[model samples]
Target: MKLLRAIGHLIITIFLTALTQVGGLIWLLVLLLASKFKLKKRYLFPMVYLVFNLLLVPPVAKYFGREQLPVFDKDLKPRHYLYPLLFRNYVVPEMKTLLEQSAEHLKYQSIGITYLDANFPFLDGFPLLPHLSHSDGKKIDLSFQYVNSKHQPTDKKPSLSGYGVFALSEQNFTSNSCIENGYWQYDYSKYLTFGTINDLNFDSKNTKLLIQELLKYPSAQKLFIEPHLKQSLGLGHMDKIRFHGCQAVRHDDHIHLQIR
Candidate 1:
């Protein structure tokens, strides 16, 4: 079964790679025509980056470093299914190692990570919905390990909404977010955060350990979590642990770890 699944994933990935090539060419042609009419040169490089990916070299372009995105380790189960095929979970070597090490540590506690947005295979400017800073493949969202009232590990995913302390009773997975479907609008209201009340809440020890593990990586740049969480965890470093601060969506359910 494992062999069959691996073969299936490979086939689908190859198909998507071909599709990206075609899509990149189409975008390039459109951009070229737009450029002929003396359109702004601003979007030129970004468009070229997309085209380069669609061409023979679909993973890296001059806009980005030569190091292409690496496929994630199978141990990290994706909270969102299409993430694997869409290549949104790819990461640099350093980040991947950090996550692997983190996973190893979490396994002793019987916990796992929920992988989220990486970036489109080729486009830097191309938007990956429900995110503002993930276009560069350096940013990733992951669910906090949820624990029961006794603080024991549970089968549940992350929880909490909006503010961490204030949003104890709310849930976030109400979104129509799914793969194997056509176009659909995103339900931005659904999200998880710390301080989720009732039978389930974010485990402080596990969450703190996750953050500490991420910070261990030398390439680690910043961590975007809610303000209240930093205080609750007694993590007061302004340099690394920065607050997203109501700029876009509330990151209560997941922490955004970005690397240099």
Candidate 2:
């Protein structure tokens, strides 16, 4: 039983660490304190975690050259609230400025930029899992604009997680080529999308403008998206826009932006 309990703790530590960079250590601390203080483990865990994230992580992260993305900023925000709490919203100061400026440029058009998993705080090369390249604070994922069934634009994402729900073109050249080459996990994000707005359609016009605005910044290095989207959006001439390669997952659902 002692060995079994040790294994359980190890598994939880790894899982929490993978999901939230600092969570494993905090979980362990909570485990020790909860037993000593006789507090309810179930409730104490989240309460302590939330307090740590809010009071400690952000300030410490800044000292290491990573700034946490704003959770409620009107110009730029995370696709899900959990992103900030999970410490998946940290980025270099320049990258944050680039995103905010791009969003501000599109503010007149009512095109909001909703970001997804970025690098974790406190580590320069610690893998963010599922997104290996996002280890650095220079990379981030942005959700593309989508419209409801009535053809009216909405902030509501088709997928609960703002991932998956691919915006496929009539001919999915890049997607097919990647899958045909034996990369089975290429389109795996589809499963991560908890059933949400199934009828939402990709808003090409707004999404195109958003990309264009982002590319206007000199600090913007490269934007990885599927080739079909580049052709459809008429962004073929943009030098900063490039294919992410088959090694990474498809980018038809969101734009992967990186800075110099």
Candidate 3:
């Protein structure tokens, strides 16, 4: 009886040690993965740790009430807009109108506009503009279809035209006011026509015309012309205007228009 008890205790000790080692390795893996990837650190890392502890630590399971994992039922109806990508601030109706008009002009059947920092689960591969980082409540990032010659939606970027309209140049800056507030300040006289460009094709004149039409909506007050064009148009002459907004800092890949 004494020998049997000792053997049982020895087995328990080995099992507990192995369990602790496995748990430690899992935690180490989580740390390594989190550090290596540039994803949401706060939301993802803690969730991983919590799941790990709950599964491997018997004490955690006992304290938290272990239950079978819930299974998703396909028969159940899904909610409409069930998981909308949440934005930092609510978008104004005027902005929504502008986005809708733009989408319509492009003949895109599906389009969406939300605050710049909206959490887009579907757009993980695409490089999101910096203005969409949610720092300012005014900026927004839009997603829409870029149609091809066949009238079908394609994952292509759009193109813009007109020298002063979309091009950032030194001539655009007429005064010091445009420079002082990191180029956040604007004057109507300095305004120019602008359009979107994608895939090195500038034939999308229809998109530019559509933008012009949208600007007529009274809400399209502050149109964010591309910084490259701004520089090309002489807006870069002033140090302040050259680096104003997030676009001035290499996020100029996309346009962030502000409707007043």
Candidate 4:
């Protein structure tokens, strides 16, 4: 009876270990497939469920250890780094340009940018999506930082640059009031452009100048500033240019640029 009980315990341990391996593989597969197919939005639910199970299942957690999953502290601070694809060099120069332009315009400044994912990789938890991640590459997100007169970030307005801004609801982009009522206000200090807005009104003259300058760069091939900005500069669309939707309309918080 003693021997039989020992054997039973061994079998249970082996089975649990195998299950954990399978679960880990599935989670990996989900990430691989989603990236390859660009199916993140489509597979979001299943991926979230898999992440939850990997984090919450007792046997799996014990076998793989909680530390193996994306690390979070008791206060839910992320300890793990996202894979480097999020910060490819192809995208960094454009980001720098936007940031520099924004900084030049602001007297007191704190800025954060991010992509639209739950991971919130950059800041502690502030959500902001980079425009380069969108299909068009023109939509970018930027947020103001509250700073002292000397331009130092204060506790009240923390630095969000590493993390990003988070609140991007579909309604923020699709509502009629978004543009008509200036619900999406443009900050000359932190300028961002979407593909819409072809109306060439003088109100957006400064934004047009920025777009003109951006177009002179070789990297502009990957960007799609607003239509009005392009038209104001008297430039036609290049075949390589593409446009993407701004999932959120309000540029008051973060600038959304569409690539075209």
What C-alpha lDDT, on a 0 to 100 scale, does residue 170 get in candidate 4?
A: 32
Question: Cα RMSDs of all predictions?
Answer: 13.5, 1.3, 16.9, 16.2
TM-score of each: 0.58, 0.96, 0.34, 0.26
Across residues 1-260, which tens digit of lDDT does each residue of candidate 1 receive?
98996577466545544433234354445456666887653466446545544453534443453233334444466654445444455555566667777777767766676666665555555556556667666777776766777878764554333223322224322221221132132324353343344567767777777788778777889997666677677788646998664445555556789888
Task: Please report the TM-score between candidate 1 and the true structure.
Answer: 0.58
Which ranges of candidate 4 are over 4 A from the true structure? 1-94, 97-139, 142-202, 225-229, 237-241, 245-260
- lDDT, candidate 2, at 206: 91
In order, candidate lDDTs are: 0.58, 0.89, 0.36, 0.33
lDDT of 3: 0.36
Per-residue alpha-carbon lDDT of candidate 2 for residues 1-260, written as tens digits (9 for 90 to 100): 99999899999999999888899999899899988999987999999998888988889999999998889987688887889988899999999898888888888899999998988988888889888599889999999998988999877788888988888655568788888999888989888887666678999999999999998988899999999899888999998999888888988889999999
- Count of steric clashes across candidates, in order: 6, 0, 25, 32
Give the higher-lDDT candidate: 1 or 2.
2
Tens-digit per-residue lDDT, 139-168, candidate 4: 343222233455444322222232222122
